[model samples]
Target: MKVIRAAVDEMWSVMGQMTSAVFRHGLPMTDKIAARTALTNFVLHIHPVRVRRSWIRMSYTLCLGGLSFFLFIVLTVTGLYLMFYYVPSTQHAYQDMRDLQFVVTFGGLIRNMHRWAAHAMVITVWLHMARVFLTGAYKKPREFNWGIGTLLLLITLLLSFTGYLLPWDQLSIWAVTVGTNMAKYAPIAGPYTRYLMLGGTAVGDATLLRFYVMHVVGLPLVGFLLMVVHFWRVRKDGFSGGL
Candidate 1:
């Protein structure tokens, strides 16, 4: 379509501009022969050769945000595959879960990978936040990015909480019950919060549906938007520190 072509062309123009900027800064790039040689010799040939060693080290450690993003991609892939076999209902949910674990081919592996990736994302994001905090990366110019990161942390927690109910077992039931009960103590918004979350006074079909939608649709959408804001803010804030 014309729209698709226009979008692609626009993307190409932006990438071309970025490439020009990088080369104009005197970052290393060579002719075809040297490029091939570097590719053959180096472990990560994609990285610019002119970067300072200190920058490389800092990027690896502090860029756990990037790792968190990678894990999120993994989660999304595995989650999609798992969703093909999952039934987000009280009646068929537990059976589908058992089938995933014991019957479906590679289903258990996919589910396990998604679970572990989710946990890793949460841990990495928290560690990334801690690193930023200790480095005073949240100061002044970076405060908005810091706020975005905080929202991402909340989204991660919400993702985990929403996922806990998918198994549709006693554990899921009671865990959600206890979690929503805590929401009932949120000052003036507590009662309304629980009502909106559960769709009723009790955790049943409606509750599962709400949580499922939140996990698969609502929260991921917010996470993605916030992630864009976070990344753009980082670039705008000038890469955090001097190399």
Candidate 2:
């Protein structure tokens, strides 16, 4: 019996040491411990460890910004799934869409989710800006973060617009045509901007490839860097509690 007890105690001693080495801190049952845990955690460091209960009411912030970020994540995942099969050529693009919808497992569902989530993100981002404006959250030290948010909103719209051409259908072409036409009204840089975007006088193979690269690689990279900065600034500036 003593021998068995000794073995059990030895096992528990090893377990305790292993847990401490892995976790660094045990359960955060107290405020001090919780703060310590938050400081040590990568994800937790992005948010303040403490805030008054009254400061975080749903009506105050509307949670729109967070929802928009969540939708972006959903779009990224579904977009990646679709990217495996999508071709950015005038020839195979529409046929690939058909195959994705009819042949691949969950492809149609993921596509629909990506589509709707994108639309939802646009709405949420706009509403988030509106909420911030209404609450006067952009008045002081938060102006920089607000600017970042604005840029993110623009990037979101561009991402959605660029993705509109991937299907390479009549509606897709028409939509992109109408959207790009608006750029021609921008004064001195209008025509040049549009030409640069299309890579020619009109939307063709070059336009399709350019849009694909921007939609998948270029804009996303810029947006992701801005997002990291935005989140970091939010952590620094603290939440703009309601007036």
Candidate 3:
């Protein structure tokens, strides 16, 4: 036990020496001989010298972006769990969905949670945007963040649209069909876009598969990547004030 303690102390000493060398040029530690007492100590390195907890709490209340991010995390987790029991094929898809509701344990609850969370994420993001806009937080240095937020709003809408067809129900089928048909209104590329989306002229097995893949994999992944950038940029730009 004594030898082990000696080795641990030696390791801490080496770490202390390394940290001291790194910060030596910037500022010298004057108070303590022990590494633990040194400001250069690794364990103490991240401790803030000064902090205003009230300011932080107020900042969070003013900035709803963090709440939006939390909702997105909830959606992602519940969505992945729902995907485990859901199949993308048209023929058995509806039956499998029914099985999820009636046969599988907690399947209905999981699907409900995912569905509700997706909706809540959309609402929270919009609220965050509204909060930013109302407070004039989008002005000046935040214009770029505003632009990213706009794109995220569009992505959120796309995510909802893509996920609409997953249940393979009449409402999902017709809703997606109508939505995709609007794509046909786009000049020369419209018809091709519609064709690619439906995988043919009409919604069927191929359409179901495409939407499922997009909802469960493609759009969510894109949203997640953009969300990371969006949050990082928010921190970089600093928190905007509330009106």
- Location of the lowest summed lDDT over 10 successive residues in candidate 1: 42-51
Q: Tell me the TM-score of model 2.
A: 0.89
Native-to-model Cα distance after best TM-score fit, residue 189 in candidate 1, in Å: 2.5
Choose 1 or 2, whichever is better by TM-score.
2
* Candidate that scores best on lDDT: 2
Most accurate candidate by TM-score: 2
- Please give the lDDT score for candidate 2: 0.90
Sorted by TM-score (best first), the order is 2, 1, 3
Q: Can you write out model 1's per-residue Cα lDDT over 1-243, one digit (the tens) per residue?
A: 999999999999999899866443333365554554455544334334344456447554567887998998898899999889998888899999999999999999999998899899989999999988877878989988999999999999999899989989899989999999998998899999999999899889899999999999999999999998887776667555543
**Clash pairs for candidate 1:** none
Per residue, candidate 3 scores C-alpha lDDT tens digits across 1-243 of 999999999999999999877665334353333333445556454333333465346544554666677777777787877777777898788988899899888989988887887788788888878877776878988899899889999988988888888888989989998999999999999999999999999999888888888887788788888877776776677655443
Off by over 4 Å in 3: 1-63
Candidate 1: give its CA RMSD in angstroms.
9.5
Tens-digit per-residue lDDT, 14-68, candidate 2:
9999989878878989899999999888878877888876568888877888898
Model 1 residue 183 CA deviation (Å) reads 1.0
Q: What value does the lDDT take at residue 210 in candidate 2?
A: 95
Candidate 1 Cα misplacement greater than 4 A, ranges: 1-53, 58-62
